[model samples]
Target: MAWKVLIVDDEPGIREVLKDYIEMNFEHTKIETAENADTALKKVTEDQYHIILLDIVMPGLDAFEFLRRVKDLNSLIQVIMITGNSTMERVLESIEAGADDYLLKPFSTKEIEEILKCSFARIERWRNAFRNSF
Candidate 1:
Protein backbone atom coordinates (compact mmCIF):
# COMPACT_ATOMS: atom_id res chain seq x y z
CA MET A 1 0.00 0.00 0.00
CA ALA A 2 1.12 3.53 -0.70
CA TRP A 3 1.39 5.56 2.48
CA LYS A 4 2.00 9.24 3.17
CA VAL A 5 4.74 10.11 5.64
CA LEU A 6 5.68 13.59 6.85
CA ILE A 7 9.05 14.54 8.32
CA VAL A 8 9.05 17.75 10.39
CA ASP A 9 12.40 19.09 11.53
CA ASP A 10 14.35 22.35 11.69
CA GLU A 11 17.59 20.82 10.48
CA PRO A 12 17.85 20.23 6.77
CA GLY A 13 20.42 17.47 7.19
CA ILE A 14 18.21 15.43 9.44
CA ARG A 15 15.31 15.76 7.07
CA GLU A 16 17.42 14.81 4.09
CA VAL A 17 18.84 11.76 5.77
CA LEU A 18 15.43 10.56 6.84
CA LYS A 19 13.86 11.25 3.46
CA ASP A 20 16.59 9.44 1.62
CA TYR A 21 16.55 6.42 3.89
CA ILE A 22 12.79 6.12 3.82
CA GLU A 23 12.59 6.49 0.04
CA MET A 24 15.35 3.98 -0.43
CA ASN A 25 13.68 1.40 1.78
CA PHE A 26 9.98 1.85 1.18
CA GLU A 27 8.69 1.68 -2.32
CA HIS A 28 5.50 3.51 -3.25
CA THR A 29 5.60 5.53 -0.05
CA LYS A 30 5.27 9.27 -0.52
CA ILE A 31 7.45 11.37 1.78
CA GLU A 32 6.90 15.07 2.46
CA THR A 33 8.85 17.39 4.75
CA ALA A 34 8.40 20.62 6.72
CA GLU A 35 11.22 22.72 8.11
CA ASN A 36 9.27 23.82 11.17
CA ALA A 37 6.10 23.25 13.15
CA ASP A 38 4.24 26.08 11.44
CA THR A 39 4.79 24.60 8.00
CA ALA A 40 4.13 21.13 9.33
CA LEU A 41 0.88 22.19 10.89
CA LYS A 42 -0.16 23.79 7.65
CA LYS A 43 0.71 20.64 5.74
CA VAL A 44 -1.09 18.48 8.29
CA THR A 45 -4.19 20.61 7.94
CA GLU A 46 -4.11 20.53 4.18
CA ASP A 47 -3.29 16.86 3.79
CA GLN A 48 -3.84 13.65 5.68
CA TYR A 49 -0.61 11.95 6.69
CA HIS A 50 -0.46 8.36 7.89
CA ILE A 51 2.72 8.94 9.84
CA ILE A 52 4.58 12.03 11.10
CA LEU A 53 8.22 12.08 12.19
CA LEU A 54 8.63 15.26 14.27
CA ASP A 55 11.52 17.05 15.91
CA ILE A 56 11.32 18.06 19.56
CA VAL A 57 12.87 21.52 19.65
CA MET A 58 11.48 23.87 17.08
CA PRO A 59 11.05 27.63 16.65
CA GLY A 60 7.30 28.19 16.75
CA LEU A 61 5.97 25.10 18.48
CA ASP A 62 7.59 22.48 20.61
CA ALA A 63 7.03 18.79 19.94
CA PHE A 64 4.82 18.40 23.00
CA GLU A 65 2.45 21.15 21.96
CA PHE A 66 2.54 20.10 18.33
CA LEU A 67 1.65 16.53 19.26
CA ARG A 68 -1.23 17.71 21.40
CA ARG A 69 -2.62 19.89 18.65
CA VAL A 70 -2.26 17.25 15.99
CA LYS A 71 -3.74 14.50 18.16
CA ASP A 72 -6.69 16.68 18.96
CA LEU A 73 -7.06 17.46 15.29
CA ASN A 74 -7.00 13.78 14.36
CA SER A 75 -6.33 10.97 16.72
CA LEU A 76 -5.68 8.66 13.81
CA ILE A 77 -2.55 10.57 12.84
CA GLN A 78 0.39 8.58 14.20
CA VAL A 79 3.28 10.79 15.37
CA ILE A 80 6.83 9.74 16.22
CA MET A 81 8.92 12.31 18.07
CA ILE A 82 12.63 12.31 17.15
CA THR A 83 15.33 14.32 18.91
CA GLY A 84 18.98 14.36 19.84
CA ASN A 85 18.15 15.32 23.40
CA SER A 86 16.27 12.32 24.69
CA THR A 87 15.87 13.33 28.29
CA MET A 88 13.86 10.94 30.44
CA GLU A 89 11.38 13.68 31.21
CA ARG A 90 10.84 14.50 27.54
CA VAL A 91 10.48 10.85 26.60
CA LEU A 92 7.83 10.37 29.26
CA GLU A 93 6.12 13.58 28.21
CA SER A 94 6.00 12.63 24.55
CA ILE A 95 4.51 9.22 25.34
CA GLU A 96 2.04 10.75 27.77
CA ALA A 97 1.05 13.31 25.19
CA GLY A 98 0.10 10.63 22.64
CA ALA A 99 3.21 10.10 20.55
CA ASP A 100 3.33 6.60 19.11
CA ASP A 101 7.06 6.38 19.74
CA TYR A 102 10.15 8.43 20.58
CA LEU A 103 13.30 7.99 18.53
CA LEU A 104 16.70 9.35 19.43
CA LYS A 105 18.45 11.24 16.68
CA PRO A 106 21.49 9.95 14.79
CA PHE A 107 19.59 6.72 14.48
CA SER A 108 20.94 4.01 12.24
CA THR A 109 19.17 3.01 9.04
CA LYS A 110 18.27 -0.31 10.62
CA GLU A 111 16.80 1.49 13.60
CA ILE A 112 14.76 3.71 11.34
CA GLU A 113 13.37 0.70 9.54
CA GLU A 114 12.50 -0.95 12.82
CA ILE A 115 10.69 2.15 14.01
CA LEU A 116 8.85 2.38 10.73
CA LYS A 117 7.72 -1.22 11.07
CA CYS A 118 6.44 -0.63 14.56
CA SER A 119 4.73 2.64 13.69
CA PHE A 120 3.04 1.14 10.67
CA ALA A 121 1.78 -1.75 12.77
CA ARG A 122 0.28 0.61 15.31
CA ILE A 123 -1.25 2.69 12.57
CA GLU A 124 -2.84 -0.39 11.11
CA ARG A 125 -4.36 -1.25 14.46
CA TRP A 126 -5.70 2.27 14.83
CA ARG A 127 -7.15 2.17 11.37
CA ASN A 128 -8.85 -1.10 12.11
CA ALA A 129 -10.36 0.35 15.26
CA PHE A 130 -11.54 3.41 13.40
CA ARG A 131 -13.20 1.24 10.79
CA ASN A 132 -14.83 -0.87 13.48
CA SER A 133 -16.25 2.28 15.04
CA PHE A 134 -18.44 2.64 12.04
Candidate 2:
Protein backbone atom coordinates (compact mmCIF):
# COMPACT_ATOMS: atom_id res chain seq x y z
CA MET A 1 0.00 0.00 0.00
CA ALA A 2 1.14 3.51 -0.71
CA TRP A 3 1.22 5.94 2.21
CA LYS A 4 1.22 9.72 2.35
CA VAL A 5 3.04 11.09 5.38
CA LEU A 6 3.59 14.54 6.83
CA ILE A 7 6.41 15.22 9.25
CA VAL A 8 5.88 18.38 11.26
CA ASP A 9 8.60 19.75 13.50
CA ASP A 10 10.25 23.06 14.26
CA GLU A 11 13.73 21.62 14.00
CA PRO A 12 15.38 20.91 10.67
CA GLY A 13 17.37 17.94 12.01
CA ILE A 14 14.33 16.12 13.34
CA ARG A 15 12.42 16.64 10.13
CA GLU A 16 15.32 15.44 7.98
CA VAL A 17 15.99 12.40 10.16
CA LEU A 18 12.39 11.25 10.08
CA LYS A 19 11.96 11.92 6.36
CA ASP A 20 15.15 10.08 5.53
CA TYR A 21 14.44 7.15 7.82
CA ILE A 22 10.93 6.63 6.55
CA GLU A 23 12.04 6.95 2.96
CA MET A 24 14.78 4.40 3.50
CA ASN A 25 12.61 1.88 5.30
CA PHE A 26 9.18 2.20 3.79
CA GLU A 27 8.45 1.45 0.18
CA HIS A 28 5.70 3.30 -1.73
CA THR A 29 5.70 6.09 0.79
CA LYS A 30 5.49 9.79 -0.04
CA ILE A 31 6.68 12.08 2.74
CA GLU A 32 6.46 15.86 3.19
CA THR A 33 7.85 18.14 5.88
CA ALA A 34 6.80 21.35 7.60
CA GLU A 35 8.92 23.29 10.05
CA ASN A 36 6.05 24.92 11.89
CA ALA A 37 2.42 24.30 12.74
CA ASP A 38 1.17 26.92 10.32
CA THR A 39 2.93 25.37 7.38
CA ALA A 40 1.83 21.94 8.50
CA LEU A 41 -1.77 23.03 8.73
CA LYS A 42 -1.63 24.55 5.29
CA LYS A 43 -0.18 21.37 3.86
CA VAL A 44 -2.81 19.29 5.59
CA THR A 45 -5.51 21.35 3.99
CA GLU A 46 -3.92 21.02 0.59
CA ASP A 47 -3.39 17.28 0.57
CA GLN A 48 -4.51 14.04 2.13
CA TYR A 49 -2.06 12.44 4.51
CA HIS A 50 -2.32 8.99 6.00
CA ILE A 51 0.12 9.66 8.83
CA ILE A 52 1.49 12.69 10.61
CA LEU A 53 4.56 12.79 12.83
CA LEU A 54 4.19 15.95 14.92
CA ASP A 55 6.37 17.63 17.49
CA ILE A 56 4.88 18.83 20.74
CA VAL A 57 6.40 22.28 20.78
CA MET A 58 6.10 24.63 17.80
CA PRO A 59 5.93 28.32 17.24
CA GLY A 60 2.63 30.08 16.30
CA LEU A 61 0.29 27.26 17.28
CA ASP A 62 0.51 24.66 20.00
CA ALA A 63 0.77 21.03 19.02
CA PHE A 64 -2.49 20.15 20.70
CA GLU A 65 -4.28 22.84 18.80
CA PHE A 66 -2.71 21.69 15.54
CA LEU A 67 -3.81 18.15 16.34
CA ARG A 68 -7.34 19.33 16.91
CA ARG A 69 -7.44 21.23 13.68
CA VAL A 70 -5.92 18.41 11.69
CA LYS A 71 -8.36 15.94 13.18
CA ASP A 72 -11.14 18.22 12.20
CA LEU A 73 -9.92 18.19 8.63
CA ASN A 74 -9.42 14.42 8.49
CA SER A 75 -10.24 12.19 11.40
CA LEU A 76 -8.79 9.19 9.62
CA ILE A 77 -5.31 10.67 9.51
CA GLN A 78 -3.19 8.86 12.11
CA VAL A 79 -1.30 11.39 14.17
CA ILE A 80 1.71 10.36 16.22
CA MET A 81 3.03 12.90 18.66
CA ILE A 82 6.82 12.95 19.14
CA THR A 83 8.45 14.93 21.87
CA GLY A 84 11.54 15.06 24.02
CA ASN A 85 9.51 16.45 26.90
CA SER A 86 7.54 13.43 27.95
CA THR A 87 5.06 13.54 30.79
CA MET A 88 2.21 11.32 31.93
CA GLU A 89 -0.18 14.22 31.77
CA ARG A 90 0.83 15.10 28.24
CA VAL A 91 0.51 11.50 27.11
CA LEU A 92 -2.99 11.23 28.51
CA GLU A 93 -3.96 14.55 27.08
CA SER A 94 -2.63 13.68 23.64
CA ILE A 95 -4.53 10.40 23.59
CA GLU A 96 -7.66 12.07 24.81
CA ALA A 97 -7.28 14.76 22.20
CA GLY A 98 -7.19 12.13 19.41
CA ALA A 99 -3.57 11.25 18.90
CA ASP A 100 -3.22 7.75 17.44
CA ASP A 101 0.19 7.18 19.07
CA TYR A 102 2.98 8.86 21.03
CA LEU A 103 6.75 8.63 20.89
CA LEU A 104 9.56 10.28 22.79
CA LYS A 105 12.57 11.96 21.25
CA PRO A 106 15.94 10.22 21.03
CA PHE A 107 13.97 7.17 20.01
CA SER A 108 15.49 4.38 18.00
CA THR A 109 14.54 3.70 14.41
CA LYS A 110 13.22 0.37 15.65
CA GLU A 111 10.72 2.18 17.82
CA ILE A 112 9.52 4.23 14.87
CA GLU A 113 9.19 1.09 12.79
CA GLU A 114 7.02 -0.49 15.46
CA ILE A 115 4.72 2.49 15.58
CA LEU A 116 4.47 2.57 11.81
CA LYS A 117 3.60 -1.11 11.76
CA CYS A 118 0.77 -0.60 14.20
CA SER A 119 -0.44 2.45 12.32
CA PHE A 120 -0.42 0.64 9.00
CA ALA A 121 -2.34 -2.25 10.50
CA ARG A 122 -4.95 0.05 11.93
CA ILE A 123 -5.33 1.93 8.69
CA GLU A 124 -5.67 -1.28 6.72
CA ARG A 125 -8.31 -2.49 9.10
CA TRP A 126 -10.24 0.69 8.73
CA ARG A 127 -10.04 0.48 4.98
CA ASN A 128 -11.28 -3.08 4.98
CA ALA A 129 -14.15 -2.25 7.26
CA PHE A 130 -15.12 0.66 5.11
CA ARG A 131 -15.04 -1.43 2.00
CA ASN A 132 -17.09 -4.14 3.65
CA SER A 133 -19.66 -1.64 4.78
CA PHE A 134 -20.39 -0.51 1.27
Candidate 2: TM-score?
0.98
Full-model lDDT for every candidate: 0.91, 0.94
Off by over 4 Å in 1: none
Q: Pick the candidate with the highest TM-score.
A: 2
Give the winner by lDDT: 2
Instruction: Give a tens-digit lDDT track for model 2, residues 1-134.
Output: 78999999999999999999999999999999999899999999999999999999888888999999999998999999999999999999999889999999999999999999899889999999999999
Model 1, span 1-134: residue lDDT tens: 78899999999999999999999999878999999998999899999999999999989877788899999998888899999988999999999999988889778888889989888888888779989999
TM per candidate comes to 0.93, 0.98
In angstroms, the error of model 1 at 61 is 1.6
